[model samples]
Target: MITSPDNDNNRDEPMVFIVIAKAYETEGGQPIDLHVMLTAPDDDTAVRLTLNALSEEGFLEADLDQIGMITGAPDEEPHASAYQGALEGEVAIIRFA
Candidate 1:
């Protein structure tokens, strides 16, 4: 499990977050759907980590729509894979082309 560098939540387990966002790769360009899944100690940390990850992934700007916590791993494709990746300390992103 991965937590933000500044996270102070002392929980032993990481909380899974699913963030829905619209991102732009270029100025004035069309928006892209960027859904992310990751583990963090808290909601604030999760948002921060997601923003940083988006920047690192080359997104110029992003507008987050929602952030939800997952009580259990998903049983579907894509989401299931993303959830597993989050457990292994990765910021898993799902994109639709």
Candidate 2:
């Protein structure tokens, strides 16, 4: 994950990620729940961190909420590799695991 700004001019950009996990009963019954809500310096880092933490804790299934520019597109939805990279950093969630 690139911690600092992409450009020479340092600007602190923030990204948010939400993690949702299901609550279960003793016999493995189901009751869905929003497990955690976290904000990281970037979305890739946030999702990657959340997945790693949950996986280490032995959670099988979870949902990821990626907001802001992290969804790989902006308001206009431009089809450019550089544009996508500019919006979302070059961090892949699976790599953390």
State, as a TM-score between 0 and 1, how close model 1 is to the true structure.
0.85
Q: TM-scores across all candidates?
A: 0.85, 0.37
Off by over 4 Å in 2: 1-17, 20-31, 65-97
- TM-score of predicted structure 2: 0.37
lDDT of 1 by residue, 1-86 (tens): 65657566455667899999999999999999978999988889999999999999999999999999988888998999999999
In order, candidate lDDTs are 0.92, 0.45
Largest TM-score belongs to which candidate?
1
lDDT of 2 by residue, 20-85 (tens): 445332345454454343445665766667666655655565555434444333344222432344
Clashing pairs in 2: none
lDDT of 2 at 72: 31
